[model samples]
Target: MLSIRAVICTLTCLLFSGLALAQATPRAPGLTFLYSLNCTLGASLPVGAGPNGNRVVIPITGGSFKGPRLSGKVLPLGADWGLIDSKNTFSADTRYQLQTDDNAHIFISTSGPAQSDGFIHLRIKFETGSSKYYWLNNVIAVGILTSGNGYVAIDAWQLTSPTKA
Candidate 1:
């Protein structure tokens, strides 16, 4: 009877251990909507097939962005030097400048791969000298790109921890 009780206790402990492990699993980071950028594009300047892939430079004419935190206009002086690999996988590499409605300048850089959903997923980084927008310099941002005739639209989001600091 003592041996049976011991076995039962061991099984209970194992089951509880599994439950504890499940409960302790880390949670995924949350996303906070950052901004939406809609920028007009000029003609695609094909660079032909390079050593890496087919390169193309698409000119950014101008655009606007808005969000809960900030609103801005994309300066008309940027380009997307995107590439298409042999497997036809598109990778986006872009650099742009933004001027906030309040007149602060922010430089933006983004790079990522095109997804199966016909949208490019971007890892965005920002640089700015304005103290008001300095937080953008440390932001972990992402964006989804959807391009249409003469333009591209990106909906950006920032990753946030579940707990407030």
Candidate 2:
């Protein structure tokens, strides 16, 4: 009976251990951790919602139009990217990339004592895939105190990973 109880306990611990490990490290399959950024950033987007609506939106803020214009630095604490701007640009350069079929899962975490050099922006492009049921998962968090108080900025582009079957 004692041996039986010991075996049961060992099996239970092993099963639960796997679950805990999975929770700690979730991954989105088929995509590689492309690249990331910190501190300051930049870009430009063209838009056309209407004559009075969003005609053109571009990320032309970070630095020089032809140079590395973004400034600032942040530690990986928490808080994802905020929707500073959006345009009809056909580029996924501003965000992370995951290349799963249509049902790929994505997880993002943003933690930080945030800060900005009074600069932030985003642009949207065509979500292209062969699958018609493509889904998008977006999560943005802002842990920034840009006015009186101070905060650190962790540009999200720094943390990217991939998962494969």
Candidate 3:
């Protein structure tokens, strides 16, 4: 009887331990809408294929944006250094500068997967010294890129969770 009681106690402890370990972690917070910037792209200059992928460079021509908290024009000094793989998936590394209507200067970089369905989803980051827009420096942003007529539009969103100070 003593041995049976000990075995039952051990089994109960193990069951409770398993239940505690099985609980899921907390989910990340949702995204908040930030701003959208439309950029025009020049013709693609294909650099041919290699082991990594087929490389191409697309020039950033010029464009403008307007949003709730920020508005700006995309400067012309940037380009998308893109790659195309054997699976036909497209990815882009794009860097550009922006000048706000208030004369604040910002540098932006973005990269992510692009689908042939005419849309590119991007993870975006920004660099700026303007005190008015400094919150952008710390948040993780996501963007959607689509094109029509003569330009591409990027809709940007910010994750709502605050980062550690």
lDDT of each: 0.95, 0.32, 0.88
Q: Give the per-residue lDDT digits (tens) of candidate 1, residues 94-163.
A: 9999999999999999999998989999999999999999999999999999989999999999999887
Candidate closest to the true structure, highest lDDT: 1
Q: Top TM-score: which candidate number? A: 1
Q: Give the TM-score of candidate 1.
A: 0.84
Order the candidates by TM-score, highest first. Answer: 1, 3, 2
Tell me model 3's lDDT, rounded to 2 decimals. Answer: 0.88
lDDT digits (tens) for residues 14-58 of candidate 2: 999988887855565332222233233233244445443343222
Give per-model TM-scores.
0.84, 0.19, 0.83
Q: Which should have the higher lDDT, number 2 or number 3? A: 3
Clashing residue pairs found in predicted model 3: none
Error of 2 at 95 (Å): 5.0
- Per-model root-mean-square deviation over C-alphas: 4.3, 14.9, 3.9
